[model samples]
Target: MAEYTTSKPEWAPEKDDENKFACGVMSGIDGITDTTVGNLNPALKNGTMKPKRKMVLSVDDYIKGVSSGDRVTLARAITLIESNNPKHFRKAQQVLQGLLPKTGKALRIGITGVPGAGKSTTIEAFGNMLCDMGHRVAVLAVDPTSSVTRGSILGDKTRMGTLSRREEAFIRPSPAGGTLGGVARKSRETMLLCEAAGYDIILVETVGVGQSETTVRSMVDFFMLIVLTGAGDELQGIKKGIMELADAIVVNKADGDNLLKAKVARAEYERMIEFIRPATEGWRTHAYLASAYKKTGLKELWDVIRAFEKVTHESGVFKRRRDSQLLDWVHSMIDEHLHNLFFDDPVVLGRMPEIREAVLKGVISPTQAVAELIHIFDVQRATQRHVDLFHPENQK
Candidate 1:
């Protein structure tokens, strides 16, 4: 054994230093890597992935999507319009500003009826007929949500299986989300998107709940109410307000054994409609019978819609009505936003418990409690404004 010595290798310290230096370089690189890599998780250096920031879609991007006829973008745009967030609200307004010129060109028809009235079947036939005539059609069906889950079945697509498969037709089912109206919160915006997408005919299908008829009526140029024949009530049980809003009443399911019954129902509805006020000047409210499943009388229905559109467009009533509706929508949205904000104030929310207790204990009347709560909110808002005005640091 030629002097088997246990001497440490001379390069051992150098090798150890090199390994340590390599580790240090890697650590340093990682420390600055997030800034260089772009959108990297800050927590990677701290042993976890950071949460991603939600994308803030720009108004320009949204307008481009609308102009480009991108359906997914249109859906997202409507979501933005319906959002209660201040940022999204402002962004949606900007998008609408860009799209205002392109909208109001399509014929908006609102169709509604009570459940089991064959509204979906009628809409399918109506949409297919429009498509056959070389026109693009969009059908928006608003489904009421289940009270337990607050989620709508959103099964309008299933009911409209035929129309859903059409290339020229776009069918969207939106949850009513407990909105009092049959239409969804951003349905008006969705209509604008459809119009921008080159749909000449837009049909708004409301919930068959009867309560939403007025809401749906106010949004469309033409309103058609579909009723079944066997009800025997004719227009008596029908709300006068709803009858007063209809441009036309259609008695569906007129084929097979129900033809005579449908005719009788139509005659009854026609007579009753005559007693109610007309929806527009020079346009008499008409009632007709049809079998949507059999595709009978759809042409006649289209003819009626066309006649109304022609008259309204030529008389300039269409443009005026659309403009007025736009204004009404603006005011309505403002009122809704203000109502939500007023009730959402921390001061108001915080006082609700105490206010309820006081009312229960008879220490204060409900009316007085409300007044006091309003006063508290007013003071809180005034203080916030004062602070915002005087705080130079905050202004900076």
Candidate 2:
């Protein structure tokens, strides 16, 4: 047999040949026509190896997980507390009850600024600096929720890219959920949980709402406001109440063309703060200038915070404030529980429709309706106690 050679005619389909579809010169510049690839790795033949199913954690498991500084567990614990569900709420409370002793050890700092005032940028620089100093930093950045949809903007982590990737740093962006202070309803509890997880520095970023300043002040050991230059004194003048709440204020974006303006703003703030009582006892509030983009003034800001902390601690105001805050938390919780109970109580629910109708029809005054509702509530409580004391099953 003759060996195959070019003596064989070069095969070419005719113009009208049906087989021409399968014959064509390779076009290197042709765009990708399909996404087909060869077989996947054999190890993933049945299915890609998935993470193990998370084990159901007990209260003790949650406590131990947080104490050991497990980020996954810490995040899950926060979610548990943030839940509005009753069962999760109970479990979250139990977790906090067990971890209370470990809390109040961290420096709680609240940071706020107007929209576009570079809050997330400053936080990234500040948090990265702290992490480099061998400190564990946890950032709870509260994002505003949409009034109509109740959804969050939730892009803080995206802005703090460098710090978010650091091992010693943890960033959690939580929705404000209509909370007044720009802090979420569970923010204080979440901070306590982070403290138990051994974070030495906790930075809470508010939603930048005007009223949030006072609310943040109530919950944090130190409150710092980041303000921008070139916005004129009008913004500052309008926010005097917020200014009075700050332990310190930093004029951010102090580089480029804004440097001089920043210096002037810093001076103006210092003079304005002089007349107001200092937020922290035994410490004077100060304003400094910074460029988060250039990473300047951060060290000075940290120094001022340390000075405030030291002075307050020495004056015993630190402990006193913590005690006062704990009392406030108790009262706030009581009020919230009472509010829920009022609407959920069987007697209140049964009579509310009639009372509301009567009030609307002018048959009873609003105040009278309220008094009548209180009377019904008292009567129901008395009846419940009597049943608990005499009921056959309850006796056992």
Candidate 3:
């Protein structure tokens, strides 16, 4: 029942707040007048008020909604954050700008391990413990996007049913989009939004496949690697990259007959930690045995996280790491954006079909096609430069 004013399109802005317009109940357009607007049936307006197409939620609206604890708005904000559209990308940045200062207070933890390591179950138990201690938690689970369909399984909700249903917890499963980043493109923005929304703990769960472990390590304050026992090749198969990044190694499923093997794995991980240089200052990575299914040893894990948080927060290293991560993110985003722009040029797009036809016809090799495309772009730029030089407006 609340009426909200709609801002101009992302491409334009009004001169003053007074010129800002309200979203019509039916049409998302702002300029409809009393004569024309009233002529439209009220029922048509009510039936056609589609939020998805007409007006995408701005970052300001998203932050306001989340801060006010509106779950539907929060979900929509995450969707906008994950969108790949150029306009959505710009809007997402606006949202992050407003939310960044309110963030950095939460403990950002990244957790990864091989499939079947009970990662979700561990997160549920760990999240429940934090909630019991009166902390609000947000979990970001990264699922691999289907290469064929470009969709994700989104099974985190089903796997962490109990924790997902918690009032104080928010669970979001994001598609990796085959980037090898082990997270959705906008996960960092989502993290800031979650922290701004008053979550004291932010857990990022990534698929434990090889290079993704390294990606997860670069983004979090603390990295926890979960593992399971009874896999005889555990130590041998565990990559050095994953082992080196782990701030804490948790051998989950340690209850019942798995207890002995879990202890053995824990000791092995401890020894492994000793060989790798500690990743953080004044923090010694440790390993523990736990059973997420049985809800045992979760308290110890929380204690370890709390200890790490306290030390990092006091030393000021946490803030430095976040700043460094932001720099890295900026550089990466710039490179990706420019790369997309170059490839998405109309000149490039128009030539793609011709290039493909040449390749199909065996008239040009793939490498030759690339060379020809580059040559075409170079020639086009040269012609544009000539035209500009000839124009009197270019004299300046």
lDDT of each: 0.77, 0.81, 0.76
Task: Quote the positional error of residue 313 for candidate 1 in Å.
Answer: 2.4
Cα error of candidate 3 at position 140, Å: 0.8
TM match of model 1 to true structure: 0.79
The local lDDT score (0 to 100) that residue 249 gets in candidate 2 is 86
Candidate number of the best TM-score: 2
Q: Model 2, 1-396: lDDT tens per residue?
A: 122122212466445554545544421222222112112332333356643424357788889999999998898899888877555666777889899999999999999988899999999999999888899999999998999999997999999999999889999998888888788889889999999999999999998877647778878899988888777642564455787778888999999888988888888888788677877778788889998999999999999988888989999999999899889888987777667667767878999999999999999999999999997886456455344433435422
Q: After superposing candidate 3, which stretches have Cα over 4 Å from the reference? A: 1-60, 236-240, 352-396
Q: Estimate the TM-score for candidate 2.
A: 0.81
When sorted by TM-score, best at the front, the candidate numbers are 2, 1, 3
Q: What is the C-alpha RMSD of each candidate to the true structure, in Å?
A: 13.9, 13.6, 11.4
Instruction: Identify the runs in model 2 with alpha carbons over 4 angstroms from their true place.
Output: 1-53, 233-240, 357-364, 379-396
* TM-scores for every candidate against the unseen true structure: 0.79, 0.81, 0.77
| Top lDDT prediction, candidate number | 2
| Reference-based TM-score, model 3 | 0.77
What lDDT tens digits, residue by residue, belong to model 3 across residues 207-276?
Answer: 7775556677778999988877776545643454777777888889999888988898888877777778
